[model samples]
Structures are given as C-alpha cells and as structure tokens.
Target: MMLYPSIMKLMEKTGSRYSLVIATAKRAREIEAAAQETKNVDGARSISKAATEIADGTVVVFDADDADSADEVFED
Candidate 1:
C-alpha cells in the first residue's frame, strides 16, 4: 500500500517500533485475518486500553481499501 512506504520511512526516521490497528466495521476476526495475511505486520491486538499503547509515538498506517499488491513494501 502507498501508506506502507511512508509508514516505514517514518519508523526509520524516528527509530521507533510500530503496530497495526484495524478499525473497520467488520468482525474482529475478519480484521485480524486480513492483518495476518500481511507480512511484517507484527500482529493484531484488541483496541481497548491498548488504545493508548497503540496510539503511542508510533505512526499508524491506514489502507482505505483491502491490501493487495501493497505487500511489496515489506519485500527485500
């Protein structure tokens, strides 16, 4: 996804770690499943009190639509 490169660049520039949060109206399982399909995604966690944890200094990457050829960003 176009956002991936920017997100990665931000991470590199800030020297910070990151996480992904899926906020679609879809079921949590579906969101997790979609994230599971992504490499270097780390993993998906509930967005409860973890919201603050997720909202830390790290940058949040968003994909307006389903992720497709965007996976190339994580490639060597």
Candidate 2:
C-alpha cells in the first residue's frame, strides 16, 4: 500500500523544513538505537519508524518558546 501518511502531512506537524529534518533524523537514530523500546515493531527500518512517529505526533518538536520556558524552570 501507499505510505500511510504523506510527507506534507508530516511537514505540517513539524512546522518548518529545518525542524522536520532535525526531528526526523533524531527520531530515526532513537529508533535504530532502541527499536524494542520504541513504537516501531521489530524488523522495521529506522527511517520508516521515524516518519510514522512524526506523522502520528508521537514525537514533539520543541521550538524557541518551549526552550525559553524550559530555561526558566532551571534558572535560579
């Protein structure tokens, strides 16, 4: 069958091309390194799993606002 979620759909979730690229690559590495613990089933390639997670919104991409808030939490 065709891919479950189109690239555009995944891109929309990420918001920007650079963010999409960064998120997908980081997720692919996570899947490859921890396939059993990850949402991806055994034998699935990392890239596919990454794409699927992005489409499903399982991976949250933190932007500048999120980072600023995070810093506030850690600051004295």
Candidate 3:
C-alpha cells in the first residue's frame, strides 16, 4: 500500500527516523489540543495532518543541539 507523505520524505526533513517520529507526535498533540479547545473536528486523523504539515514545511523539528541557546529548542 502507498503511504501519503512517505516515511523517507519525512526523514529527509527530520534527519532521522527517531526525529521524524518525535516531530510528528509533537505536532499531532498540538493539533489535538487545538481541536479540543475549538470544538472542531475536520474528520482528519491528527497524525496524518501533522505529517502533512511537516511534509509541506509548515512544521519543523528544532533540535536542541542545533540551537544557539536552550530557549531556542522549539520554533514555529
């Protein structure tokens, strides 16, 4: 079966399988929380939506090691 936003493509952005998983899960949680507050459900799975965002470059993984400071760990 074909996977939209294939894992390899996501790894290209995240640099590793582990990083890709971390980034995807974090974004998915954010999407879920927002949906809860807004009382909105677009009928799309949170995980898939998050993956799409990463694939489209709308979301990114900010590695703490690559940051200039501790506070710069995560970015929008």
Best by TM-score: 3
Q: Please provide, for model 2 over 1-76, each residue's C-alpha lDDT reduced to its tens digit, 9 standing for 90 to 100.
A: 4376687898788788888889889998877778566655677677777888888978767676689875775585
TM-score of each predicted structure versus truth: 0.23, 0.69, 0.84
| Superposed model 3: Cα runs more than 4 Å off | 69-76
Better candidate number, 1 or 2, judged by lDDT: 2
Model 2 Cα shift for residue 5 (angstroms): 2.1
Residues 1-76, model 1: lDDT tens digits: 2333354544443334432334312334544566678743554453322333233533334454425533654553
Pairs with backbone N, CA or C atoms under 3 Å apart (clashes), candidate 3: none
Alpha-carbon lDDT, every model: 0.40, 0.78, 0.86
Question: Whose TM-score is higher: candidate 1's or candidate 3's?
Answer: 3
